[model samples]
Target: MDASLLREREAFLRRAKALPVVEKPRAVSNAVNDLGPPPTKRIASSVPSDLRSAELRPALQGKFAVLSSVVKYMKQRHLERDTHPLTVEEILEEARLHDTPQSTIRWLEEEVGLIVVTKE
Candidate 1:
């Protein structure tokens, strides 16, 4: 092919390969308009001072009982490798599981104490 024809073909190919450029609108917002309202903060009620308050004692006793039941079960069932005493948190979790009934708690405490004494 001749150089002039080749040059024309290259120019046509270049024009075909080039893409059209377009400008997209930039996102813009006024600071005053964007700042519409301030966030609201809520304060929680203070905990009661009385340990035996209607809301307090039952929750605590229930938790304690639940934990005691769980701890006793763990000792008997060997749920974990550690044989150390159950922490308040573990007892609470167990209590949570057992629904922490007062009777269950008292029974578990008695049972656990007896088992401990027997083992010793």
Candidate 2:
């Protein structure tokens, strides 16, 4: 085989691999947004507790700042805890409830107090 022919074949293969054809779906407009009274549902708040439960609805909810403050306070409680040392199971359980490990640790510490911390 000619050396030049082998080189040409390799180049052709590389080109074919690089420029494979693709068929993308076209964007379809349903023509629905302008034909209705808009959505009737309200967004729910994140840190919903009994104290703020009444204010969680869209009609009564405050700004995101208030929600953020509640989250910050929750986190602070976790960090400042001197209770028991957090176990892996307890940590995982807390994480399941709040979707955050830090929040779980704080909550567990709050629940058990001195039991969760170590003496040393």
**Model 2, 1-93: lDDT tens per residue?**
999999999999999999969999855576575457777898786665875854554224333333344445547657888344455344344
Q: What are the per-model C-alpha RMSD values against the true structure?
A: 13.8, 11.8
C-alpha local distance difference test of each model: 0.57, 0.52
| Candidate 1 segments whose C-alpha is farther than 4 A from its true place | 1-79, 87-89, 95-98, 111-120
Query: Which candidate gets the maximum TM-score versus the true structure?
Result: 1
- Residues 37-120 of candidate 1 have per-residue lDDT tens digits of 877898765866563364543345554545455557677647567565564345546545534455654555575442432222
| Pairs of colliding residues, candidate 2 | 78-106, 83-116, 83-117, 84-115, 84-116, 84-117, 85-116, 85-117
TM-scores of the candidates are 0.24, 0.23
Segments in model 2 whose C-alpha atoms lie over 4 Å from true places: 1-9, 17-38, 41-120
